[model samples]
Target chain A: MSSSFDPSKYPELKNLLCSIDKIPDVSDIRPETVTEKVIECNSNCPDPRLKTLLDNLTIHLHDFIRENNVTTEEWMATVHYLTDVGKKCTGSRQEFVLLSDIFGIAALVNSINNPSVNGSTVATLLGPFYTGEFHDIEEGGTIAPAEGPGEPLLVTGRILNTSGEPIPNAAIETWEADAEGLYDVQYSTYSEPDHRGRFRSNDKGEYSFRCIVPIAYAIPDDGPVGDLLIKLGRHPYRPAHLHMKIEAPPVYETLVTALYPRGDLFSKSDAVFGVKTPLIVDFELIESDEEAKAKGFKKGPFRRLDYDFTLATKEESAQAKEKLRKSMAKKA
Target chain B: MSSSFDPSKYPELKNLLCSIDKIPDVSDIRPETVTEKVIECNSNCPDPRLKTLLDNLTIHLHDFIRENNVTTEEWMATVHYLTDVGKKCTGSRQEFVLLSDIFGIAALVNSINNPSVNGSTVATLLGPFYTGEFHDIEEGGTIAPAEGPGEPLLVTGRILNTSGEPIPNAAIETWEADAEGLYDVQYSTYSEPDHRGRFRSNDKGEYSFRCIVPIAYAIPDDGPVGDLLIKLGRHPYRPAHLHMKIEAPPVYETLVTALYPRGDLFSKSDAVFGVKTPLIVDFELIESDEEAKAKGFKKGPFRRLDYDFTLATKEESAQAKEKLRKSMAKKA
Candidate 1:
């Protein structure tokens, strides 16, 4: 069939796209046959991983379309919606990642790739707000502006391995919304990074930073994903969360997670499905003026949050993921 | 839960975007529980059909992800590819539809919604190449430009119903590629439609027009869908086919279809998976001078294609689709 294709007629396509030699016969396609035809068509993918992914994608997508009886108009609407979401993405925003977050796809993918093991921190969705522009801060230093708005907060945590030993000098990236439910990037005249910082744990595996208490915030809802949330009877609010990415180089798998302060309105139903129970911690209110001064707060009645992050070595994480994969394979 | 979400703090979100009243607890998510949690979270969607669609979509998508062990990198790649496709769509092009076409999703959706009934001609994908810019021509008039490039051809067809009755004055829109395997819009100098026209069937339900013989063409390959085809070891050429959209108004279902001339190298493996055996027709080579002049061509060596389109009435099509749905439901 490859030799039969007469590319002599069109010089532009002559050697650029070699005509395929083996094509599944898609001539007699019916509803029952279309899925197989599409799958077999992709059987020649050079990467086995990609081939398997496409095959499974074809099977599930076709089954969903057929089983749900998705009408043409509905499908077209969906396509249009997706296009709008993509168009909404720019240097400062990523609507595709937002869509995945709300769909729990990003979380599921994160969970699958970084399954829970050895009591390590559970990974969550790395949302659209993370930027590559965080400035470094020292221990007990503030991530928020020097005179930022909000109740002052002190967060202290140590990075530890599964064996309860300190894993010192781990790199940590932390970010949070201000008390007004806005990130630094959400501001129009944002020049310098605020409320987000990169720092490393001390030799004692201890990490501490001062910032405004995290607050429940609405995700940007002007795009198609926001429109979808409305239709799905969902709200675009995430509970008060401190985004954290912790990495102990060489051995431990990096942990991407969020610390949700307890008793937030939206914690149980975070818009991005980012909250896990163990990651929720307490915020103790301290009214002692001396204690506030000691913690670098300007005044009393500041909040104190103490939590510890556990790390799983790379091998532990891989073995955990492999076990889950084997169990899923058995079901399949 | 409804009372628990204290929106008192954020006045901006005060009256707008009411926090969801019933949200499933997503606190302890796992692969085994995430899909259901997400689905349950959406249980409050007011539109039942949308809910059903979302539910099926969630089920199949999660299953595909888990079963394939789709890694974060792979899923991210898919998401980014879809984003690129959406970004590529403009006023003159639709990359999402093209993506759906090559994946056979568009064809399968078309097949499902317009299931064949009692000798009715099957419907096919209304591909991305279709445009709303064709000029209207009279019966027996030529659709191709006076000096267009291609072998001369006459297309004569009648729109009929399953009972063999003429569907009079049906609106017909027909389009085809030029000899160079390019649509009129594919050209940089596209000021007017050359090989496409909108016309109506005659009182006798016959539609005839002069056009160039369609040629197999490569779909636009500079986009993500094209990249995917290469990765899947597939070509980008669609078989030579004359696209047609026929509608007889209030009684018959609109028929979106194309006729693939027999013996095209890409027919059995149409890149968009739009081929159906029943739509493959014979293009007779007529070399007689008299016949060519009678058909309004300037000389001999022209082609003649004669085919009849049998459409299903709206009711018939609906019944066929319902029957299929019921059967599928039984299986489910």
Candidate 2:
């Protein structure tokens, strides 16, 4: 035991331990010879987490190369495949995000970071195509353009403090797909602006909006991200829902929530895994033509939803913002 | 201790210690919220190694976000950027592989798995663009079809077993850039179908090929991978070299190696970190007009290199192949 522990023999022992003793002469080796080359090349990674990840990756990658005895031609094919994925990105869509989403990394990160909440909204993947900055509107004002397609929806929601007391004023930024299930950002044919708006609640802590009930649609699939999904046998559809961010005074929490249409097939299996139980609520189908007429909507029928949000206290708000800022800086 | 552990009095503690308790309302909790999230998220990671990595990554990611307090627009920009990287991949070249290279993932993986083999050749990144299926050529034949730009070179090498015995009939595959420092695949102008070729050693374990000396060149830019490199402040160049792979009988190991030309500055800092000390060899500039004339080449000068490679024993060869196979299967 003592002999084995001798540090003076480390060089030789390490050779044996790593199984590099009697190193092969420079010729007559397999195509997998590059495996060691790769491992040696990446040895300098400094971050411990990255170090471990890379190390494990190397072992697996090398093992992969050797196991298949991968030919030089096959390796080259992989390179070409990856190059196409890079060429497919555009302003409106990202293939890589779809790649990550399909690979489960996006879901994994969201799941790891967002713990469950009881009697409150659950967080989900924010997705890759959410364009920020919305036109602010007054409470109860109609935000969706008149020409946009959708059954008028009267969306009313309250911003409440953690103690269940109403917060007098809160800003709620909302966006969603049109009746045809397409966001304005996804279609160039639509007007420069449609189907998205921001509203501030009144002193009564209530905000309302009028827009058509959005449809459920599939994520884009004509790109490399789509190709990968097909290769992996997965669909790219997301459940129907309205995205919102509710913010009040520093004492109240800012809620990033999505209210899904009840009983959508994709509600249980969101592509990015963003759905939470609390965020699932009923979209009541009202048959009262009188009610639709009172709201200045078409006389056929309408859907209505009322969502109440509870915010965290002031100190928590500051901390959350600070944490988010730090993470963003690091990424930059 | 009993008081601190009370379920009714300290709901957060109770929730954390046992899964039966109600989900803790982490929102609006102040600085502790971030810390709690980190701990909670890390606790769910199943892999012990990954768990530790996630813990550190969360801390850093969170810190960066908080420091920058990045707007949703900026976050969306990042998402789009990554998406483009995914879209850029084709069937051959992978932008993500290049991304990983520039971000150090490639090098990190290389080093962690390649323990030092004192006398054995070191490996490097195979890169995102190495296509296989080289043309087959007879021993003492040429890989170059046309003059192909560079001065003609006579490369001769030997394949030997680990015990120093010559291994006859070893297969060798070779490829490299021309005088312009571009592979045929990189340019549509080059119509040389057999620029790359595979050969087998003679009974004396000797092999020779006629080809132009390859020059150093920069990796491709003008894409998302390029943008990332610019952001990270890195150059994209590799030194002059010839890529070679050798395989023989089961008695010895198989080898994939690159023979770098002596006196290239970038050899020391190969962008892909593929340089190996043992693999570096001198290509003599033959000034003998008589020698050049005898070889049917331009009379003033040419280059020649002689290299010999030794392989490990059979058991080691099997182990390496097994490892490679496992890794390759995982990707498939």
Candidate 3:
């Protein structure tokens, strides 16, 4: 045998040698290999649930990259956009949450985690403006201190269980934009407790408040999220709606939902994807002055809406509570 | 005929009325519907390329969410992590680039953009620390300012074409970590021109530099990226190597690459996935003071490495240039 081996004598070796200088396909990422490496790295994660979550996330993310064959420039642009979204987030603004809302992720997650029970109200996005605190108002009192625009309206609702029995003293938090399509938070010279209030249902589970009928309003669009919406040729307008957080006794799962007017132009095309058909109600027009006065309304031509909210059973509520607790605990 | 006729006679109508009050699945986000809406929003984008990019991105992102069924908590955690990563970025630090590197995206992009041509040296990641400025030194000069603890190293290299012809006057920029395994950028007390320099090949396309041998070093692990590495059960160590950017006249595509020492602990498992087998070179040991002195060194023990870099033809170089130009134009 020769001390030195010659590759020229072997056709297979020659072919391999010839390929040594060949140019590789630029977009070839070897996604399978990359996915395996990522999974291996996360294999020893201390939390099994977290490991599973990361594993699934990695698989999905890698699959997306491979499926799209995303180029370097496209990936960098995404990074820049995401960074801008983060940088835009402040104490009063959360662009990421806004992004989630627009993508329907928030609504989807809310629905998935809190399945409806019987005829209980369905939960929706909590939204970013919830302050967890509102000025208390007497039953059937006016939530709006000074109405700037839109039609005068009266909203009356009852909180009950699936059995059609009233739940006395249920706490209700409600807020909506004025006729000018501006939330109290959006006003530069605004004060606390204007066009927003918290009220409690009476022993009969009847609650009422007076305000201007809500109108379609655009979300704040000066930030990165707004830019994205504009790029997508999508309007930022949400349908005319009222946000409410109802907490009744015996059901620990709080119901955070919005009630949309049935005839709003954007009712079926809410920018935030926060609308549901069941949550839509008609703002009935009441023109009889005498009947309006009997209902404690001083004037005629006011819109009236009556909606009844049902709470889920205690067992159902408990299951939702457990699920939320587990999900929250997984973060730690 | 009575207006209220029929419901009593039609059992099916009665059943439909009863079921109308049933609670719906609140979190029911039809991903297909959402995807379609998003696509519709971007239908009028001024830039067709942007429209395509956004379309693909939205599809992939939505698919990932639906496939993984990511929970609200998990999504929030991801948001928080990305926000932190952005917040940590400073003028001298770029966490996102590090993330891309660790994920093998950087290497993939570099390889894709700059494919090897006729045995020309393959390009690797430019890395985050490359500032595009290096102090020019004469040929056969030392890059290291002071000898540290590691063995002395003498590196000699030639710049040539695929046809084995010398390509004289090739500008080469080289950098490496010191004996303490710290790049100048990583040291708190570091100054300029330490363990890094720029030089040119002579008439025969030969160049030489003296320095301390490099050792494996851990990447910056004091930030969010570091935290993620620990959580993923991965070490942040990069294999011992020397970085170089070689550019010759008429070749617009500057080759950015690195040469690794054989047998490094992390050679086979570089944290950034940047190591390529062809880039590894053996360091021959010399143990005679007379021999070292003959090479203009006064030391007894020294390691020597000799490697040749080949440049591609004009056509191959032009292709890379066009690709990069197109990529850059997209950003603007």
Candidate 4:
């Protein structure tokens, strides 16, 4: 049978045999058999959710190749693009998160995990700059200290529980770039404390601060994330806003909200796409003369914004936390 | 107002004010208002699809952050892992595809795109080892030309339309590694012409090939794909099989099929989860001393496999191509 068997009859078989011949003692592996390797590796994924995810992913990915007849080159290009996205991350930023944000998966997951509460403010994506601890401050204090530029403004807001009761001692940590739209951390010329402030609300659930109104600004654009934005034809500007995280008892629910100044062109079109109608408020202009004197200011023409936040019920807030924990565990 | 605005009232405000005094104006292109700047630059996304996506992602991602209060360090690790996955890709391989495959997006897309035809062979994911262009040979010729190892076998298969009508003069390209489980492209030790071959069907839609029986083997390790397998605690071996592509007249649909060696353990549990019952076949061992002599072989045992491929109807095939083209155009 060996003598009669014609190797030329099966070209694939011939190639396999030839390739195998070059390596001593080891046999040639067929292309048709590679599927098992892929399946086995995917099936044992430690996280059940991830295992299921990988399993499904493998099937579609394989089918994509078969259906589209994808070539080796196209596949390689995708790899290179992803690699650059990873290389772009810095200490304060993450490009992968940006990728996820653009892909809609992150949004989908968010929607699935975070259902709206009756009265609590809806949470949103924490932009890359969230460094956990913010300094503690007293009520009616100025969060912005640098005397650089822009109209001086007195911003006041109250934090309330779901039942409409005020949370007098709520901690509101606020951070914003200076009038030129630069964070203290981003500038070498600025000290560690520049442009970021942590303040606590008064007994009446009211907190006020004095600072030059911050200017709308763009995220850092010199990295790969910027390159991707260029490729996608997107500008990087975010509307003028203050970053505030108000945390009280778990019953009140923590609120991570961005207050966008009304009338910014891009307010309706935030680059990271994080604008809610409820979050937009007018930074009412105050002519410096009379109002400034009432507040004991010697100057003219400033701005003032008064906003109030209501939280969710304690049980509802706890449920949100539970849901979040499950999702994170699944992800891990 | 200046006298009433107490910077010391807000401790958090004091931190920001005291942390740094000078914020740089790097670009000189500052917006007039902070809210305007945030809306214009921080989240100014344009693509409607991407805009919606980012908005939702931010909400959910933020919720996750607030729910677990994810620390900066944990988030940094995720960033690093993603970067590593990106760095793993090379010219011939894609770690992202593997990542997507494991994540299930690949399989989902495949199922969404490739609906199966009734009675025709179901399509499965194309495992990674595809290279372009195969050498063409006449019908009834052997693809395997070298004297390598494995039980001598004759594989005869027919290509037919969905109506069970045979398609004449169909070009069928066949290739597989030898018993050792290595392809010519992977090994430099073997000559280029060694194990690979292509053959066209005869007028009767019949093709035969002579070659050694293929053995199941694992995919290549020593790469990111391998590292992933090790991390997931998976074996990389695949079941034995042959790869064949049957393409006839334009009216007939082209079919890419893999014939799995029956009874292989990995067949039912293909690593990539690509196994389908219809694609499996048995290679029956026969005692044929006399038959071997007729074929000029001094052998007592020989192997034979007889299989047939049924394609979708001409019109159906054309419709499939049109659908595929439209989908591809949409993606492009």
Candidate 5:
């Protein structure tokens, strides 16, 4: 779009040339109005659900800017920090997930998606450590390979329906850190997924795995998220817990959850806010050499955990999913 | 920090144990309470201003999540997109600055820092194109160097104080795109800052330079911010304008701003919202070879701009700075 101008030389035209559109007299629009307009514009998004979600997000973001009166320099700094978090993510590490976990967003999402049904296991955060490439272990086989370091502990559980019936052939996927508080994938000494495996429920709806009891550990702190935690004066340790994802055929939905050892120091202050009462279990000491020998162990004493996980009927799961969808779709 | 359990009979524990301080059971806190605690925890930030800003930001971010009921997948997607923007940044390109520009944040900051003072020239955004490395050019000399493309034009102005007295020897830094709407720095063909330079005012506070009349151009839209603008159905074109940053000795403060051509299509709708009423000027057609010769131009039929910029008193500038600092210092 070109400015209107005459190429012809004329004394009268000279005076008019300098006066054309010379003043930007447009009224200033408030930043608040601009934010509202942005939200309105996104309302036409193809996906109604996504539009609602984005609209709310935009509003909160703008509100935050206004409330904080954020400066240009501060804003740029935040943008840079977020970029760092993204760049820090790798196949083995998910910084964004860590951010979500520390902020309690992961737990919120879990609760929203998997409401506690009468007798079902209380869902907790899946955390940033699940590799999903777990090998299938024979019933009661050791998931913590001989090479990994941790006290021998056995985890046994039963999968059952709300009606108290056994959910035969259910898959129970499990993973945990070594005694030193490092997940198998986090080790520089190993390249493969260690101390993580899946086991099938027996005809009696029973599943068990030999692994080390997880120790309380700090989330990765060498990144931007860690820097933020330090700045906020928040500790980064999560209570010792075992990550699990269980699934059964048509009767139940996939459940991603975790179980924490009872009485952990960081339990009340779990850094990621992923702890739940029902998910915490007490480990009992067993000192039978005969039992260890029968279980194919060359050792005597072991810590044993016996917990049963309950699943909701498919209808209950569908209801929870629908509830979450509706809640996420709330229009501004 | 070791778990209080026997290790003698457990020979396996002796070899594998690593002092597990394992326990995780404690009463659960609601996510809402967690957010509140996070905000409260920041009350001890050494810098009150930073603490307030962070608190407000955290509140809004958490509110956005709660209000939108953002799903895990959506949150992860946003994290990924932000990371992409950071990765796209380099020495030559600042995607974050471009983002701030598109969101109208840069304009808001400029306006906040430099409110209109009596006759002072209005300040606009110092866009990402400014490399901060401007070469000094002699009065009436061409700033296009020898290789850029555009029709010849001349800009002449006087720097004056609010009382209308000339401010001699002031430095005026100028930059803009060529006829093709590409800034010198935006072109790979030119490795240095071309079509951009600084010039000093003469004895009577007069300044002049030879350059191509700037054309309307789009901000870089090959990144996430551009994608956002597209998604928001917003145009990315900025009005044709010449960027300038003028500074004088003690009595006057530095001014970073731009002057727009009258009647440009984007004058009223500048992409970054950098346009203001007093910053637009008109260009007069100069058709006399004799007059062009007198003005140190080798060509006729060139455009000439005649304008004077006014500066604020030092007292006014100091007040603004103090106000900004105080505003940025509010805690809790």
Candidate 6:
């Protein structure tokens, strides 16, 4: 223990300066050997998995500095930027997620963990908006508020297994932005959750909910992440998409994914990299008043989306994730 | 501009969503191609230098993630950890700098920026203790308070140019921790600074001051950085050292460095990677009452540190830095 470590001086910290017999002393550090010294410093981590992650992180972080010849000024500026990013976090906003999203790291992690399995519906980003606070509604009920701000859309989908059989009682939660491309959570008027709902698949595996048409929306642009995007000369627009999460648990691996609307300008360059080829769908415009009335809409010309989600069993998904990871490692 | 970007909704953001004609739309992103996509997202950065840095950053960061197969949970954990680190910063404390120091990045940056030139002194980490707030003191005056802690020590050094000529009137600032290994800035009782002083070299390039001997100190251990050190199996102790900054700007580059005492256990592995072999010095113990009283100490036995610093002219130092950076790049 450092003799100077007074418990009263650092009440927040645990007295962890015990025997370091497991840690090896490092040699003198120079530019050429500092990375090695740092690596050896981390070699005493008890968790082997965490140790590997930190080791790789150090290797890449140091390499970035050396390759770019990054100056102290540039590094300090990055530190300030990151500090601003952290300060911008709130209950409804996550600037760090936006940071990862803009860099496509979130997409890459999604791809790595949710690799394709047995023709199941491809998964995408969970985004930064899922609050998991929606009240459960009956099938065919409306998730949109009674006085919502957009054209009504009816989303109906059947949950099926890879072998083409119904998977009943699966929970599905969905959320989206209003006509102004703003989520309820993004508004000052937001009190209770809006434009979101939870429902369960019936015995026939059918699910339906009424919602406003999702529009292209910008990720929060008043934060450090937005500043970074602007500095990179990129737009902050994500294509129109509906966020969905379905879970059967124990038997089925929960599917966290989204569906993007086709023909959106930003679909080709969704700021968050949440778009995948298979996840894109077209909404058919139904202009029949009789059908609209049956669907509890006051008028016609509402959008209609009919799709089916194929889910992979837990065992199948585990196998696919391991196989893909091993294959990627082999390729590397 | 994104059509969904409403100015009223995001009043904090400048209306920066302009034409991205310079930004080419990216293709479909997959695990294998997300890195390429993200890199191209930054291709439109106007500053070519910044663009290169971002490109290289994307390459290395993505490589780290893919090579390690970082999962969403692990990535989110990292995000939260960074947020905590940022939140821990204050007027006196810089958690980010500590983060860099422990990883040896601060040392690497210091090494890269201040490469040796013509037998001039090598530099090390400036550390997080410097406040640049010391009051001026006459040569041979005591910097320690009348009722300070620890044994007395006398520090005398000469400032010289590379050719061994005296560099008169160079301003030198020095500071150190108390016997308890804590700086005045770290204490609740601290108001006016103690144990630090600023002085100028005389015509003979001689500078001297009296201070209490600095003891090995632990970096702030109540924060996220201390928690990280414990997890990494490393100690937070830096060797006992006196921090110094000598400036003769315009003619010579300012030098910010420290002198480590020999025989300290942590000297070989300074927690912040600030130790350099050349900067380690032996403090001679003198038991002569006449000499001790002559140095204005209250007692006989006292420690004396006599070390001279050699500096390079600004032009010489700049050339050396550029040469080292280029050579490092070539080696990489």
lDDT of 5 by residue, A80-184 (tens): 776677678776788888877766666666666677676788778777787787878999798877535676788887898888889889988998877777877
Q: Candidate 1 has which clashing residue pairs, if any?
A: none
TM per candidate, chain B:
0.91, 0.71, 0.82, 0.68, 0.85, 0.93
> Considering only chain A, what is the TM-score of each predicted structure?
0.92, 0.71, 0.81, 0.75, 0.87, 0.93
Please identify which of the two predictions, 2 or 4, would achieve the higher lDDT against the true structure. Answer: 2
Query: How big is the positional error of residue B279 in model 1, measured in Å on the Cα after superposition?
Result: 1.5
User: What residue pairs clash in candidate 5, if any at all?
Assistant: A24-B277, A264-B23, A264-B24
Tens digit of lDDT per residue, candidate 4, span B1-332? Answer: 11112235333334332432221211111111222322233243336544443343333344344334444344545556676776655444555666554433333343333334656665554555545446665544455653457667668878777777778878776777666676665575644544456777777877776666777766665556556655554544456777777778677656666777777645643434455677777888778798755543456576788888877766775566466656755754
Number of the top DockQ candidate? 1
DockQ of each: 0.50, 0.08, 0.12, 0.08, 0.23, 0.46
- C-alpha lDDT (0 to 100) for residue A138 of candidate 4: 54
Q: Tell me the tens digit of each residue's lDDT in model 3 across A217-260.
A: 77777888888766554556677778889887566456788888
| Candidate 5: regions farther than 4 A off | A2-27, A40-51, A184-190, A249-251, A318-332, B1-27, B184-190, B248-253, B293-297, B313-332
lDDT of 6 at B118: 96
CA lDDT scores, all candidates in order: 0.83, 0.58, 0.69, 0.57, 0.72, 0.82
Candidate 1: list runs displaced more than 4 Å: A1-22, B1-22, B188-192, B288-291
Q: Which scores better on lDDT, 4 or 6?
A: 6
For candidate 3 chain B, the 10 contiguous residues with the lowest summed lDDT are B1-10
lDDT of 5 by residue, B212-258 (tens): 88888778777887776655545566778899888996878788888
Candidate topping lDDT: 1
If scored against the real structure, what TM-score would every candidate get?
0.93, 0.65, 0.75, 0.55, 0.83, 0.93
- Lowest lDDT sum, 10 consecutive residues, model 6 chain A, at A11-20
Q: Is candidate 2 or candidate 5 better by lDDT?
A: 5
